[model samples]
Target: MNIKIYQRGGFKDNHDVLINATEYFCKMLMSTRMCNTLNIRLEMRSTKLGKNGLGSCYTDALGSKKNKDFIVIVKRDAPITDQLKTLAHECVHIHQKATNLLQYRLWKSDGKFHARWNGEELGVYDAIPYQDRPWEIEAYFLEDIMHKAYFFNNKNRPDLEEKIINGFNNALNYLESERSNNYRNIVSRQSNSLEMAI
Candidate 1:
């Protein structure tokens, strides 16, 4: 149930960055009510990432009974703040999978089977519209929230002052949107129940 951090592509020179990020992320997750005594392995790696990819999170298998190991890979040379944001983003994916809100399945392709999210075989990573992907939208919307809280609480990183402000604003907006969505769901459910009773 330990979080293991690894470095590569010269990130070893800034080993402290990886350690600090892992500690902060782990602490935040531990504090959450949903995460009661984390028993899953979280592997955070700082290494060369795909072009245009700041970070990414994926598991060997996606399900409650299968492997719960989460592999979070980030750019080795990114700024500490940016790296923290990536960690937050990836951690959201881990949380989603752990909660069963996000699930995957294997699909046949060219005589081979490939894994995909929510059973959408054709919806490849980049092929899926950014906003249409609920998982990405949730992760992207919440990453800034987590980063802002961490940076504000730390308060020693003046270099990230601007980012902190931006994150704060983004978090507020996301919270509002989430509230609205929740209200809508409740109302729709109530209406359906009433109609069924009638």
Candidate 2:
């Protein structure tokens, strides 16, 4: 996936970690072909969200049957662990949208948001409580598991922790040289090593 992260308000110190985590989530949830076709933008913001909201995922159709473009807005002021968990949660929603497992449509006549899950209409969106939403249920269930898998449960990659530490060091260098117009591209190249490590 082509993932771009914009640090808008605060918590700008962990770009590399965020990038690696996003790539990991994409790899875990989607096939390689799907991953290659996706264009994901992650916006980190310090603004407050409703209630306990930590992040949200907005999927766009991009004028095609396949919805390949997505924007994920995450609360930046939260702890890094919380940020990663929220990111994992949003990534699951992206996967759901991409695979057509979850979808929403607005009815002009009734002005109500309708949801469909696995091709079955689920009635008005607001009718379903937050915890009862199937999509949210899946996302919430997998968030911490994905986070733990990326960090602690990667027994197959014994060197993962070392690589992440090294990636953070490289991130500092990248931040220092971020004035370059090709900074994103540069970080993309640097992230390749971490991806391999993952």
Candidate 3:
């Protein structure tokens, strides 16, 4: 798979170290057709988005089949595993956009029309129920599998299978942690209510 990475905004301070890592993850995550035909670019920036989130893929402006180029933006300073995971997630979105699986649900507010995907409103960054979003769910489901595959294919150790399994387990643990964080507020509220009742 042919993957291009562009680093900006102090991203080179790390001594241009992550190019190979990003290239490896992109090749492992993206499909063979996409890797071979389209020129995929990953843009990395070192900036804090303040809870808005980690990474994103933009494919809305271009024509569907003709413009096969897709962009994935990620925080340059994020942990390597997180960077990989985020890339994998955005890769799924790219596929969805490429294959016409990304359909918008239009909603009118204040006489203005807006688009959304799987009930998550687009253009606006208001908090949405993330775990319930179908696209996010699919991405979450695929990220770990992709990670495992990457490890399996890249590793040449005698315990290659073990390393692959460990990769899967590590990603699953990360997903569980995300799920816990997502619902922690609700759990805390319920606990407080129960304590009050007592």
Ranking by TM-score: 2, 1, 3
Off by over 4 Å in 2: 61-64, 153-198
True-structure RMSD for candidate 3: 7.6
Superposed by TM-score, candidate 2 places the C-alpha of residue 36 at a distance from the truth, in angstroms, of 0.9
Tell me which residue pairs clash in candidate 1.
Answer: none
How far in Å is the alpha carbon of 64 misplaced in model 2? 10
Candidates in order have lDDT scores of: 0.60, 0.75, 0.59
**Candidate 1 structure quality by residue, lDDT tens digits, 1-198:** 346666533636545655555556555544454454344333434444656778887675443343456667777667877878888888777766765556664435533333344433434444556645667766766677677767765787755755765665565465446553643543455468779999
TM-score of 3: 0.58
For residues 1-198, what per-residue lDDT tens digits would candidate 2 score against the true structure? 798999765557898888888988887778899989999898887674666778999875332255788999888788989999999899889888888878887778797878887667778988988755767756765676677667753455647745654554454355335423324554455467669999
Task: Between candidates 1 and 2, name the one with more favorable lDDT.
Answer: 2
Quote model 2's TM-score: 0.73
Regarding TM-score, does 1 or 2 come out ahead? 2
